[model samples]
Target: MQVNLHDAKTNLSRYVEQALDGDEVVIARAGKPLVKLVPVDSTPRRRQLGFMRNQGIATADVKGDFIDDINAMFS
Candidate 1:
């Protein structure tokens, strides 16, 4: 729903509640749409921090041995 800037400002709280309920809210200026209010999904990803410490990264898992090759080329 599109609303003028002044009206949007006056009913800001209601618009925000509408947005939270997954409704699209468009704020317009001089009849031109300028911004949209949408709900943001704030869900955290599952991760295990101890997994990294318990199973440390292996050196062989690395790609490209540029340091040794570069030194050999210079020598």
Candidate 2:
């Protein structure tokens, strides 16, 4: 579905919902295609926080016993 610049601006939310529903949306300027609207990847990536552990690299536990000392310094 193609829409002119003015109509795209006026009904931006409706077009966004259409795009999210897997519709191909195109914005045009002077009858020329300008841009497309698509949904972003919503999957959260898992991080390897302690990748270097057990490999001789020492790591600190930020939420461990040292948390009390850290709070005391701030107070």
Candidate 3:
């Protein structure tokens, strides 16, 4: 659906709802296309608790200061 700038501004909500319904809406200025409205993927991510609990170890369990060695290389 193509609409003029003024019409897009006036009926913004209606056009947006159309876009959300998987329709492409084009805003025009003097018969030239300026913008296309489309829906954004707003899917939520699922999070897992203790997903890799056994894959990690406590910092105190490390025998040496690993970061100190890397810093020494840059210095």
Could you estimate the TM-score for every candidate? 0.61, 0.64, 0.60
Which candidate number has the best lDDT? 2
Order of candidate numbers by lDDT, starting with the best? 2, 3, 1
- Model 3 deviation from the true structure expressed as Cα RMSD, one decimal place: 8.4
Whichever of 1 and 3 has more lDDT, that candidate is 3
The candidate, 1 or 2, that scores higher on lDDT is 2
Off by over 4 Å in 2: 58-75
Q: Clashing residue pairs, candidate 3?
A: none
lDDT of 3 by residue, 1-75 (tens): 999999999999999999999899999999999999988878987899888989987767333656787778789
Global lDDT scores for all candidate models: 0.88, 0.94, 0.91
| lDDT tens per residue, model 2, 1-75 | 999999999999999999999999999999999999999989999998988888895577777959999999999
Top-TM-score structure, candidate number = 2
Provide the lDDT at 1 for model 2: 97
By lDDT, the better pick of 2 and 3 is 2
User: What digit string (tens of lDDT, one per residue) describes model 1 on residues 1-75?
Assistant: 999999999999999999999899999999999999988879888887776575775677223657777777789
- Off by more than 4 A, model 3: 45-75
User: How many residue pairs of model 2 clash at the backbone?
Assistant: 0
Q: How accurate is candidate 3 locally (lDDT)?
A: 0.91
